[model samples]
Target chain A: MENACCIVGLGAISSIGLDVEENYESLQSLQSGISYPEFLQTLHKTDLPVCEIKKSDAELAALCKMPLGLPRTVYLSAIAVQQTLAVIANHDMSKLRIGFISGNTIGGMDRSEYFFTDYLQNQSQGQLQDIRYHECGSITELVAKHFGIKHFVTTINTACSSSANAMIHASRLLKNNKLDIVIAGGADALCRFTLNGFNTLMILDSEPSKPFDENRKGLNLGEGAAYLMLTSEAIRSEYNLHKYATLSGYANANDAFHQTASSAEGNGNYQAMKEALAMTGLTTSDIHYINAHGTGTGNNDASEGIAIQRLFGENIPPVSSTKANTGHTLGACGALEAVYACLGLRDQVIFPNLRFETQMKDLHFSPDTKWQATKNMQHIMSNSFGFGGNCTSLIFSKDS
Target chain B: MGVYIQGIGNISAQIFDPRSQDFTLHAGHGNRLICIEPDYKDMIPPMQLRRMSKIVRMGIACAKAAMQDAGIVKPDTISLGTAYGCLADTEFFLQKLITQDESMLTPTAFIQSTHNTVSGQIALLLNCTGHNFTYVHRGHSFETTLQEAFMLTQENVNCNALIGGIDELTNNAFNIISRFGTYKKEDEHFNNEGKGCIAGEGANLFVVNAKDTKSSYAYCSDIHVCSTENIAEELDGFLHVNQLQASDIDTCLLGLNGDERYDTIIANNIRNVKNARTISFKKYCGEYPSSGAFAMALACKLLQSNTTPMNLQDLNAPLNDEPAQRVLIYNHYKNQYHSFILLNRL
Candidate 1:
């Protein structure tokens, strides 16, 4: 890992905790953020348990100086990015050409759902500026403008694998010497559009999700934001930035089998993982931990487990799905789990996979249910598979 | 490494079918420039075609046509850009969720509602297991996809990447956006009432590889994406890096949506590059965030034909006496995301 793009700072606002340190503490303490929704204004709030941030929109809005009527997605992004910038407060701001590569699925649909409903009822009832942030890049543009990061700004929306692809591009930009500093991550807040969308898909587990379990019913949806500050060797040396971990390799592949469901053999997942490991020239023995994209759905867990068994054979590392804790953050899970992986590297510990009892009947390996600390925490892999069969995998290793 | 645009596919507000040798030039006559729908029954099976929205069908059709023109079976990679992805589905799902109290909602619309649906579906149809990417950076979406494609082709000259941009408007979306003053009223046009512009959308794609073939229309030399504050200076640096001067550019395509407020940005930025002939492609494709794809398709066509369409012929425009060998496409979204693309005649 010579002159790799190092993770200098991390900012996360998830159900587990509101900031990087809190999130790390929650991971170490094995505290689950899967609780009833407090802020989301959906009818299923009473029936479904979600890992939602406890702050109301107004409370979260007061955290930052944003204009009124912006979507909750923008608020979450601002909170995470604010913390990301705060982590690198000592960096020479004027000298740095910062690039904000944010990933989001539904930009302001949380607000748009409200606006459009009002508009449907009465065309003139909704505020004019509310629906303006409906597009996916709208939040990225707003956050970039707020942070004054104009050098290289972009947004990726590959469903669940979005933030993983965002990190892939961010690392590539740094490796290509396009930007000095890259803030790469994603943010997605819960809205009726996504909630009912998943509900219609009939994958929303009413109870806590158990990944890699045989009877795993479905996924418990969640909402949050996470960002990692990526800095190259030149910027690292110039600014004397502290490296938390190294983003060594990443790969993206399509299943080409189905739109929402993965292939029966998990072709895309296997290819993504194999290529990512090949990128770093690392073997299965070298990988210390596996942060699986175990969404608790029957199709996803079985397919991902098969992919893992194919890659690792009989020798599998400690595998876990933090979704049991933070729920699936949709697009932000990549960066959220990325921050968790960096924590594993920095602290040399493997977090527990919450609420897992039985292994899937179809697979040889089951996710680690209890928190386990480890000494040889070196290379870690994170997987994020999305709808339309878009799959991505990322590797993080100790900054040598 | 240079990327050669080996093939192009365009389905837009204009009736210029790329499959035909001659293009039927459609002038900028109306504010609501609607895309001339293509017959998908020719390319897609009924099963797949039934579930796809207008944008998804258009994307798949364009991608298939582009691959056919390039003599490639399947692209090694697929990257796409879209301002509003599957908007028809998004709107449908939203309307259902709101009206139906979030119950009894169908998953079909929700499944196709993602921004990457178009690119993912293209790969699925082609069985392309290679790299797949989608960019949603408003105006920079198309340019970012081109940049990703350039890097891929540069990495391996043998690699052929299918990259494109697609955007389609729904009726409710258009109505709401128009009310937000996005589009000029039909009667309000032809006056200095620069408060609104025409609404338009399209799907355009190009097959790019590092090697040139008989189908190569132009060579994509460089692409620059930046903020709109200093477009002139940034474009100068971009051209200088490519060893091209402003005068070296034979044709320049700018996005002038008839909105004096935003179009004036380009006018002021290019006030100095007086020697290059400038034309606005929005007249044909109208205006959309991903309109740069239409502009790129037009550049490929102009470079291949060695002649500008009569509809865009400006007698007083700075037309180079020499044959048009190079073309530049520059566009922005609401005076924010600035993009410049350089294409050279093969």
Candidate 2:
């Protein structure tokens, strides 16, 4: 029998709210985190709408209780990590053997960019330390240190699919008996580096992102972090822990069709979903809802819609893209959506896919744009597709 | 439960292949740092070559060579582990962003900057749309990739998997890391002199399979990764789990860069293994986050040759035996991450 990996705790901070509860409440009320850029100073500030966190660097650092002068990304990640750790307080810190895996595309880039111009002039001496935080692993190291975790630690940087891949790696390690407990998720803070990068790609939507809509322009770049505490069933049972949801199946596949674009038919996304379903031994009928990867971009929504249509046939499950609320959190979207899936299973509710309107002419399906509470929700699938044709699908189910 | 390395291909600073039999060690670029990249035109087609960066070229070359070595036309899965994926492309895109102010930036460079580009490109090249994933966790990146491959093989998901670690050197990257004191500056160059062990890059590919072939060099017994500030305790625990004592290891592959501060951790770890002869590869391969892959490739070659190269030998200890049966490879990057990989002759 496959060992069940259970999520004991979940924490999230996005443009919507600070924790899971607040975010859920906002989702229920149709509150959009999307707004005109205020925190990030960029050339496209007037043109782009982002789902940015309300906290400042100093405020976030204080909330995380981190040392001063830390990178913004680390500060935000520590906040979410500490919140998740608070729930599993009873678990032994010394003998638990916890591992940490994070996903981030731009780690400490906000700080690094500040130091970049100054360092070039050889005028700043202390700023050189900021360069250490440029690598993706540095923030993960900082988070691990905050919790005193010494076991396996890693950072995944496959763009949008980073956190989804991180979650998959964590679950796989738990199943292989490599780790007893693991905290896996991702964080990406807003900065001119990322904002400008997306702007240059011409994928930043001026208005609110409309995922799977015919008139969708592009994505709204958002920022924040989310993480889950995953442990083997044996550990959970031994500790008498409350399970949030079970990570039933996950699969990662490469599109190999383009460097940044998905295949014309979404081959990689389809294969990943198929394999994830196969791993769980679950039929299409078993899936209750799907949290789509819909970034509101012309390419991603269309590709992911085609993949979803191919997987479930014409009668698709009620699918929705929460990017309307959180924008595209990039690396954190996978874990963020995973947390949403768990919440769906817990409350027996399907959150509305905000900003979704007319179905695409290329596909014959529409998303559930209205929030509804239903009973007996079983399986929920979440998808995250990234720049390198990296596609990941994770299935979370209620404990039987 | 052991994973066998059926075939291996490596492109490093030293040419250590059976066909070439060229074990000559060449220092990288300046002083003692340089990356020895092969002529990839012979391996990759011209059309693909235009879009390929150094990392991509090196990865494709090594992957093709590994598949050829394993006598397999196509692998069931492709997994790549890279710390900084496609650094050349990343630098190119960053340069365009900074200089051009984000206008008319080529999408090609920006698209290829992702960590999974190597695995995705390899899959495209072969047209085998099997399981493909990439791990980008600093030093432990390659170890985790192999661990996943081992798990998949154990699960019978695929009998054979193509796994490799590839990182490329860039001028801007070196300059940036040098400013951070991670790499040795020219003024403080005397301490890091003679051994020009700075950040260098190349690719090392391996074909790991459930079926043990007669040509297998070694079987991977186990692997571990830890992020503890205390190295000694982690080492002891890792050794204890394998029912191994430090003295039982016949050889130790240490990732001792010429850096004074970071090399101490490696030296202290080697002190635990009293009876083992220490071997260092960074002096030849230079230093990169995923350089452990190079050390692993060297371990497989040592198993096959039944001999250690003089260039790799540590002057402090002499080889006790002509052929070593067991090897312990320990590597760390800047004291932040550490990994232990155990290999034995099959």
Candidate 3:
């Protein structure tokens, strides 16, 4: 089979670690990154825990070589993107028609909130510059400029499923022969606005998230950025480089069941998974591991589990939700988990779904609670479902 | 691959129905803000209507109208593009968090605050769980969705895709934008009187299909979205890639919103596209983030009607028998992000 899109390099910053190696090390050790919020100044810090990246905005700005006063999201994205690009530094930045697509939920909210308070005090002159960064696109534009990418840049903000859709979009563009090199992923930073928003919804877990557990509470908010360098087969062959994993198939569907809650039957999730497998020409038996969205919410886990059960039947693959490790990174969760999927292939290990006790009575399947290495890791399917019933499934395979 | 615009619906400052002969223009309310309050109850059911924000309501209303216009009961896909999604809800949630100290914040506002809420709601409403996505790339948000629709068409995946772009203005949102100096102050609008205009909100939806139905208004030939500091170089590169010369463009729709700072950049590019008729829509639609969607809707109507609306006609070029063969829409939001869309009548 011809590889549709090849992942050349990957980078990520999460509560687990700062880079790919660090995150992989933490994952292999079965360490959870969910802890009390430290950096974000919020009133609910004590009540709600978060998977926050252990870095300040100034430190991240310095790490990304960004100027002072840059939006915190941009700074985080630049660090992750720069790390990914470092692996492919020999590639011609000027000759290659490079493009970027990022998914971020609260783009530049850190800056927007700052200016929102200032505007109320009648201080508005220097504020226009911040306005440019208020929308999701501004982060993409800033990252593209920092990386010297000049073509086909945009941002997708479909909540938790944003970066998964971003990855799908990048793959489709490459399959259509639209560009040579594309950087696709998502980044998000912990903020008081999001912290309180989730808290108000009464979905924030007081303790660490227990995904797929019998007594699972709500999710723990997280912040991070991750990106992958996707190139076509021709480009990979010309460069004489090894592709980590082939992004074989991807699909997105709307749950449309609710504004926030998925349907009881998980129709959208089922359709997305079915379409993705169908596109890849693979059956449920071919898949060795499943990276579930498993936000630890009562509704999401139950709905997603039902959908997975419907698709795979009794022959369910070993499944784990990385959200227990990285928290629910929202827009960046998809990309963050994509990096973890590649790691699963390289290491031949299925990371544990931490804090699982008993299976839900509604479903027979249970996520792998212990990390185990397997040889037949050919295909790994990951699911990312967001608000607005936006659901996406991505299939990655070792053999192209 | 041919993608036809089967249905078009828009809710802007002006009446955007294609059947209408003239724009049902409204008087500017004192500060240069133009708003169109649609009777959304006609399109949305009362049960679902109560929960929707202004952006969601406008989006549902416009999407419903577009589906009706296309005579399609169920669309295969729903794709929405919004520069800022559910800002009103977002602001509400944020305000609750800040003012109430994050206690008892309503779930409704938080639920509708995601960027994909509109597209998700549309899918849920139609119960069409096929393919759904949303793009939030500022000025090129809708164009990116159009590009994705074209790719889907080329793949023969779905026959029809409902694509739309929407943005709503809230008081906090406007104030935030004003603080950045991106928005014209009330004093500036009052002093210049007619010089600078305030921002507005709107929703534009289109039913795009792979087949070229006779009802097609025009064919979207190509769309190019790039981020560059040098406007001249980017413009030249876009035209060169399409194998089109500057003179080949019969009319160029420029995004000029009376802001002298940014309008000059567009003006300089228009001057380079020699022998092409120029037009602007900012005065009519105001300067919202996704105003480009409104511009695209106007282009479709112009191609179909064979006449440009008088309110939008900046350059008085006589209509020719050539039938507005090629139309180029050049849009820039905040003078930082730019997009160019090329459309040709089939």
Candidate 4:
């Protein structure tokens, strides 16, 4: 039997809020975080809409109790990790063999860009310390150092699916008896690099994103951090920890079709969902709610919608994309949405998919437009698909 | 569920096979030791080569060669490790954004700038829909990749994973980092003594499978990664689990850069294992995040022949005994991340 990897603690910092409860409160009221850029200064700031956290770098650093000059991503991650440690505060962390696996795409581009801007005009103007944060793993390393975690710290960078992959790897480690406790999640901060990158792709939606809608334009790139404290069932018992949810099933697959786009049929998406369900020994019927990847892009919603129908068939349950609530966070979306799934399971309420008027012409069902109270919300399936055809599906079961 | 290395492909500072009986050494002088990369046309298509950076070229080449040596068209999974991924592209795009206006910037460089591009590219080329992963921890990058691969063997008895560690050296990166007093100085430089590491870069790939084959070099017995202060305790615990003692390790491959600040962890961990032969690989390969992968390839070569390379011997710590069965590798990055890998001769 596969060992159960229970979720004992959860932390998230998005545009909506700085902590789990605040974000959940927003979700309960169907408050979306999408807005005009505030802190992210870019040429496209006036042109594009993004779900940016309304905090200055100094403000974020103060919130995390860290010094200035820290990367925005590091500050965001410190907030989330603080919240995670808060929930699991009573447990003796030193006794357990802990491992931290983080998912991040933009390591410290925000800082690096500033350094480069200064250095371009003058060769020696850029701070050398800022360059140290360029690698994706540095986010986790810095966070780990702050928390005094020394074992098995690493980072994953698979575009949007990075955090979900982090969760999968963490669960595997716990199940395989490599680490007793694992904190796995991801973080990314808004910067000119991502804004221009998405702009160059011409996928930044001018208006708020409309996921799973026929009139959906494109993704509204967002930024934040989310982390989950995962522990083996035995460790939970030993610590007498309260379980928020149990990571019942998870799987990853490559689309092998395109670099940034999903296949028309969403073959990789279908395979991931199938294998995730297989891992849990559950059928499609067991999933009560589905948190679709739904980036609100023309290709993703259609592709993911098709894959949903192919997997669940005529009896598709309450399904929606929270990307409409929180813009596509890229690497952070996986864990951000996973936290949302956990919230849904705990609250037994499905957050409304903010914007959906007409059903997507290509799909049979439109996303649940209003907040729906689900009955027997035992299992919630969350999907995160990213660039390079990386697709992942994670199923969270109610803590029984 | 034993995992054995079935194939090896390396693009070190010198583009040579470690498994070859006779190999040419690329002794780099001074503080920079860039890789001697192969022709792009040899592995990638003409159009593909034009789009990739040097790191991607080396990554794809090594991954393809590993698969080729394993006699498989596609691997069951693809895992890549890079401390600083595609820095040249990242730096290039950053320079353009700084110099040229960002309004008309193209997405090609941005699209290819992500850390996961090489692994994704490999998966796309092979059309393997298996799990694709990329790790980006500093010193523990390759260790974490192999650790995850090791864990995969427990889940599935029959699994084949294409694992690689790649990083590139750029003049700008080198110049910028050298200011931190990281690289040794030999002249009127930062240190003014010019005794720093010869900054090296390369991509090393290995095909690891649950089952051994005729081409298998050695069995990868175990691996451990930690970030604690207890180096000796961790080493003792790791060897204890594998039914090994200090004397059992016939060869100890240490990640000893010329820098004295970083060699203490390695020195203490292997202090009790005085009976085993010790070799330092950083001299030949230079120092990079994933140089451990190159060290592992070198360890595999050492296991096959039990003879340490002439260029790899640590002059101060020469071996009194010949290598035999077991080789233990210990590597750390500036006292932050530590990794241990144990391999046994096939």
Task: Tell me the tens digit of each residue's lDDT in model 3 across A1-400.
Answer: 3746999889999989999999998988888887787778776667788998888888988998888777788987998999888867876557667789999999888777666555545644336656558788888888888888877888898888999999989998888888888999999988877877787677788999988877888999999999998999889888875678989888898787877888889988999999999988988999999999999989999999999999999999999998998999988999999999988887788989988887877778989988898897999999999888889999988873
Candidate 2 stretches with Cα past 4 Å from truth are A119-126, B18-22, B27-32, B185-197, B227-240, B244-247
Q: On a 0 to 1 TM-score scale, where does candidate 3 land against the true structure?
A: 0.94
Report the number of the highest-lDDT candidate: 1
Question: What's the count of clashing pairs in each model shown?
Answer: 1, 4, 3, 7
Q: Which clashing pairs does model 2 show?
A: B28-B33, B28-B34, B29-B33, B29-B34
Clash count, candidate 1: 1
Best by TM-score: 1
Q: Give the Cα error of residue A7 in candidate 3, in Å.
A: 0.7
Give the residue spans of candidate 3 off by over 4 A. Answer: A1-3, A117-132, B23-31, B185-197, B227-245, B306-311, B315-323
Please list the residue runs of candidate 4 whose C-alpha ends up more than 4 Å from where it truly belongs after superposition: B186-195, B309-311, B320-324
As for model 2, its CA RMSD to the true structure in angstroms is 2.5
DockQ of 1: 0.79
Q: Please give, for residues A1-400, the per-residue lDDT of candidate 1 as tens digits.
A: 5746889888899998989889888887888788877778888878888889998888778786787678988888889999888767865677677899999999999888878888999776787777888999999999999888899999999999999999998987887777889999999998878888998988989999888888898998888999999988767767787888999988999999998999878999999999999989989999999999988888999899999999999999999988988998998999999999998898888878888887678988777766676786789999999987899999999954
Across B79-172, the per-residue lDDT of candidate 3 in tens digits comes to: 8889888898887776666566657677778788888888878887888787788899877788888888888888774568899788898877
Give the interface RMSD values of the models in order: 1.2, 2.6, 2.1, 1.3
Instruction: Order the candidate numbers by lDDT, best to worst.
Output: 1, 4, 3, 2
Worst 10 residues of 2 chain A by lDDT: A117-126
Q: Evaluate candidate 1 and give its CAPRI docking class based on DockQ.
A: medium
> Per-residue CA lDDT of candidate 4, range A1-400, in tens?
2566899889999998889999998888888898889788776667798999999999999988888897899999989988887866765667778888899998989989988887778777788878778878888888988887766788999999999999999998887787888889999999888888888888889999998888988989899999999998888888888888999998999999978889999999999999999999989999999999988999999888899999999999888888887898888999999998888888898878888887889999888888887678899999999888899999999855
